[model samples]
Target: MLVFFTFVILLALTVTNSKQTFVILKKSREDWILDGIGLFFQGIAIPFFQIAVVFQLYQLLLPDTRASLNLYPIAAFLLSFVFVDYLYYWNHRLFHTRKLWFIHQVHHTVTEMDVLGTSRNTLWTSFFIVYLWIHSLFIYLLQEPNWYILGISLSSALDLWRHSSFSPTVNSWLYRCLSPWLILPQDHAWHHSQFIQGNYGANLKLWDKIHKTYHKSDQVPDSLGINSSLSLSKKLFLPLE
Candidate 1:
């Protein structure tokens, strides 16, 4: 329900922004296919994999530990939103390294801020993401995972928003409140820019700041994404040197 609401809000924002909507509509056919397939894999297939494969494997390997965790609701939420988020911050940073950039570069190919391109990546890229494993393990171990699940849903929704051009205005109260701590759309746009070296966090800017990787800017980059000569097949399957 929350996820649905978030989608509705993002769609409304995109529709209301004529320029943003035009940019989205103007995406190339290859962009459409890559983003569409990536979204489907991440949104549908990954969750199914988490449940049917990862969670079940945990059940088999740790049979006696199922629901062994009895954390308070707030603790559970923080476990996902803070601790796991911190882990993912590093996970995302690692993807920018030369060793792993091949698998992650496809995601940064989006030339604009559009929610549809949020999940753009090679099909198997999810396997390397920390969320795929940590989320399932925690869900399997938590006796009452409602709060944790809420955290996951909110994080996913925020990812969609931060990847899109649906941010609150800089002069607005909402932007003032969120910009100080949270990762915003413009912040992430910098991460997706031609110089994709910083702002690797998904939720909070704290990790990036602490690690001295945060690129503070009020304006979006003049240019976004890197030029890749790789064919569609390579973008979807093969990794480059």
Candidate 2:
């Protein structure tokens, strides 16, 4: 999935330079190293969380046990997507609070938008992300583990597009139609905005609208990220600090 999006962004960059488009054309080596560390953390967190999810599911599904809710597989799959998105909506907002803000601030350090920026969270943030911790449990309870994985995988692929600097051609009618339902690149860019708030949904804009946290504007933000005085090491060890 990462390679595929990298190719798409490269192709888009060839057609439109970063200045005209939202795609960030250049990234520093330090940024790449930070992203690598983030990925390393993600690698560790994924297996650990998966183990916990499996253990929880095993406890729920003992020898003679049945699922708590047995909806049709298709319905369960669809509902899982909504459930995770809803979970993420609130959890993401919480991360912006004073307590969790420092941990999440690593990702926002990027002054530009790119696919790699999506992976740029702190070492522990991935582990504590609400969706990662609970989404699998919801999948098991719904009795749609396979379908749920597929749905979330598809949703995640779409999320990669949201982080890109690329935008659809103005002539494309499909872009206009789906712009409202899905989080487009520009909409998400504002979420990374230095001075702006709102636009906090991941895959769908429904929750943001319902919660009145949605920021609807075509204007790009003036800058990205907060001005921090902490040293790099201090920022990385923010949780402990």
Candidate 3:
């Protein structure tokens, strides 16, 4: 729901505000098809994955904790912002390694940044993502706290914004203050650069800083994605192979 709604809103913004152009890649029909296939596979996998997550959470929960909501909803909600982002940082870093890079490469293939562009990886990419699996399990174990849902809602909105082409003007004090800790569109746009190793944060920049992978610079990347071209079959199956 969050992903769907965010995509719609951002796409609308992109279309309406035509004058503010930040497109890096010229999108083609092939690109749209690839993203659509990925999105379809992702939607199909999620329900099945959640079924497993539910069963696993049931097995792990204490007998007395059944049918209970989070005792500390606020803390759980606040903590999810840090916890989920922390998990994303490591999961993302792992994708850049030699073995996993192929699975993630599709996302960077498009030089452009957009709401749909971010979800353009191969079918299995989302299935094996560590952060998604672990985060879902955690939410189930916590009994679906309201705060946790709220935190995720806020984070998902930001996620869409970061993937979109708009780079917010950083002149405001709020931007300056949050720029260090939170990821903005500019921060993530650079991650799609050919130099894709650094800036692996999801919502917060703290993990990248701690791991010494944070990158900030005035220079926009010269180019995006690798030069290698992949066939449709390869794009769909090479990651698994």
Question: Which structure among the candidates has the greatest TM-score?
Answer: 1
Could you tell me the lDDT of residue 62 within candidate 2? Answer: 56
Q: After superposition, how far is residue 70 of candidate 2 from its true place, in Å?
A: 2.5
What are the per-residue Cα lDDT tens digits for candidate 1 across 1-241? Answer: 7766876788788878889789978989999999999988999999999999999999999999999999999999999999998999999989989999989989989999888898999887899999999999999999999999999999999998999887888889999999999999999999989875899999999999999999999889998998888889888886532
Measured on C-alpha atoms, candidate 1 has an lDDT of 0.91
Candidate no. 3 TM-score? 0.84
Candidate 1 vs candidate 3, TM-score winner: 1
Cα lDDT tens digits for candidate 3, 64-176: 55435554877777767788778878888898899888888877886666666666777777766764565555565676566776777777778778887666566777777
Positional deviation of 5 in candidate 1, in angstroms?
Answer: 2.5
Residue-pair clashes per prediction, in order, are 0, 2, 0
Q: State the displacement of the C-alpha of residue 218, model 1, in Å, after optimal TM-score superposition.
A: 1.0
| Model 2, residue pairs in steric clash | 22-165, 23-165
Q: How much does candidate 2 score in TM-score? A: 0.80
Superposed model 3: Cα runs more than 4 Å off: 1-3, 19-25, 43-48, 51-69
Measured by TM-score, how close is model 1 to the native structure? 0.96
Best by lDDT: 1
- CA RMSD for every model? 1.6, 3.7, 3.1
Off by over 4 Å in 2: 1-26, 43-48, 52-68, 235-237
Residue-level lDDT tens digits of model 2 in 115-159 = 666677656677668766566565545554667766666666666
